[model samples]
Target: MRSQVITGGPFTGRHMLIVIVAFFAVVIGVNVTMAVLASTSWSGLVVENTYVASQEFNGKAAAMRAMASSGISGDLLLRRDVIQYDIHNRDGSPAVVDDVTLTFRRPVGDREDFALALTKTSEGHFEAKHRIEGGDWIVETVSRRDGVTVMHEARRIDTAEFGQ
Candidate 1:
C-alpha cells in the first residue's frame, strides 16, 4: 500500500465573513420581528396626556372612594340590541340620577369606544336602544344628577356573557 497524506482545507477569511454575516442576519431578523409585533400589539399609550391624568388622579381616586363609601352601586346589562343599567343603594332601594352615560371601550384601544346617554325607563333603571358589537369591553358607568357625578364605576365585560 502506498502512504498517502490527505489534508483538510484551512478556515479562510471567507468562512469568517460568512459566519459574521449569518450571525448579524439572525439578529436583525429577530429584531425586526419583535418590532413589528410590539407595534401591532399595543400602542403603549395609557393616556393622551400623562401629566394631566396624573394631576387629576388624586381627585378621581377620592371621588371613587366616596362613591364606594356611599353604598351606591350600579349593574350593567348589555346586549347586541340594547343596553340596560340598574342603580341601587345599600338598602336595596333604587338610586336616583338625572342622567346616565355608558361608555363602551375596548380593553386595548379606543377606536371602537363610544359613549351613550341612557334614558330613564323607571326608578333606578336606564336603557338605550343601540346595537353594540359583541366583544371584550371596558364599560364605564357614570350617573350624574344636576351636572354632578353621583356614581362612577368601570367594569370589564364580554358581550357573550349577556347573550350578545
Candidate 2:
C-alpha cells in the first residue's frame, strides 16, 4: 500500500501544468471543430418534407373553434374506471389538441393532485382512466393547441350519480 503512494517529484508541477495545457488545447480544438461543422451548409441535406406544416396549424385552430361551437359541456368527470372523451374535429381540419393533461385536485384538504395520463383513442379523441375514492376534485387540463383555455375551475361530475 505504501509503495502505491505517488511521491511528488521535481517534474510533478511542470507535468501537471503541461497536462492542463494539453487538456485545454484539446477542448479548444474540439470546440473549433464543432463550430466549423455547425457553420457548414447542410442545406442540400435538409428535406423539405413540411408541405403541410402551415396547414396543420390552421387545421388545429379550426378544430378548437369547432369544439367551442359544439355543445360539449366543460366539466371534470370523475372516473373509477376509464372514461373516454370524444374529440370532434371540424371538416378539413386536424385535432388541435397536442397534449391533454388532466390533474385531479383534492377539493377540501390542502391542494394535492394525481396526474391523469391521456391516450389518443381515435383521430381527435383522448382518454384517461383513473382509480379514485369518492371526493370532490378539481381537474386541470392543458390544451396545447390553444394558448388560452376556454374553461378553468374543473367541475367534478360523479360517474354513477350524474348522467352527462
Candidate 3:
C-alpha cells in the first residue's frame, strides 16, 4: 500500500490571516466606540474659571455652613415618578419658600440632565412629577424665597439604593 501525504488540513496560511484580521477588527472596533463615547460624554471643563472658582471656594463654603447653622435643611425622596422634597427650619418646622427648582444631572453624561420646578404642596413640602431612570444621579435643589435663592444643596444619589 502507498502512504498518502497530507498537504494542508484546516490550518492554512490564509485561514491564519483571516483569524488575525478578525481579532484585530473586533479590538479596533471596541476601542473606537469607547473613545467616541468618552469624548462626547464630558465637556472637559469643570468650571469656566478655575482660579476664580478656587478663590471663591471659601466664601461659598462659609455660606453653605451658615445656611446649615440656621437650621435650614432639606430632605429629598425619590419615588417612582415623583420626587418629594421637604425643607425644615431650625425649630424642626417646615421652611416655606417661594419656589423650588430640582435639577437632575446624570453622573456619567449630560444627555440625561433635566430640571423641574417643584410645586408647593404644604407648608414646607414640595413635590415634582418627573421620571427618573435607574442609575446614579446628582440632585441639586435650589430653594428661593421672593425670587432670591436662599439655600442651595446638591447631593449624589443612587437609584439602586432606593430600590429602583
Candidate 4:
C-alpha cells in the first residue's frame, strides 16, 4: 500500500490567514470605535489648569463652610420644562436674595450646558422655564445679595428619578 498524504483541509494556509486577518480586523475596529466615542463624549478637563484648581480647592471649601455656617440652604425641584429653587435661612424662613443664577451642566457633555437666571416667583421660590432632556445633570445654584455671593449649592439630578 502507498503512503497517503492529506492536504487542503480546514487548517489550510488560506484559512489560517483569513482567521488571523479577521481577528485583527475585529480588534482594530473595536479600538477605533472606542477612541472615536471617547473623543466625542468628554473633553476631560474640569478646569483650565489642574494645579490652579487644586490650589483653589481649599478656598472654595472654606467659602462653602462659611455659607453653611450662616444656615443658608437651598432645594431644587425639577419638572418637565421647569426648574424650581427654594432657599431658606437658618430660622427656616424663606431666604430671598437679589440674584439667583442656575447653571445646568450635563455629566458627560458640555454642549447642552446652560445658565438660567431664575425669577423670583414667591417669597423664596425662584423658578425658570427650561427644556431639559432625560439624562444626568449637575445643577448649581448661586444666590447673590447686593453683589455678594451668599449661598452656593450644587446637586446632581437624574431625570429618570422623576419618571421623565
TM-scores of the candidates in the order shown: 0.77, 0.41, 0.77, 0.89
Candidate 3 lDDT for residue 152 = 95
Off by over 4 Å in 2: 1-79, 89-95, 146-153, 159-164
Write down the lDDT that model 1 would get. Answer: 0.90
Model 3 lDDT tens row, 24-110: 999999999999988999867778999999999999999889877777889898888888999989788999798989999887778
Q: Residue 6 deviation, candidate 1, in Å?
A: 15
Segments of candidate 3 deviating more than 4 angstroms: 1-31
Question: Candidate 3 versus the native: TM-score?
Answer: 0.77
Q: Candidate 4 on 75-116: residue-level lDDT in tens?
A: 888888888888989888998688799988998878999999
What candidate 1 gets wrong by more than 4 Å, as runs, is 1-23
Lowest summed lDDT over 10 consecutive residues: which window, candidate 2? 40-49
lDDT of 3 at 78: 81
**What is candidate 1's lDDT per residue for 7-115, written digit by digit as tens?**
7888899999999999999999999999998788677888899999999999999989999999998888876787889999999999988889998989876678899
After superposition, candidate 4 runs with Cα above 4 Å error: 1-10
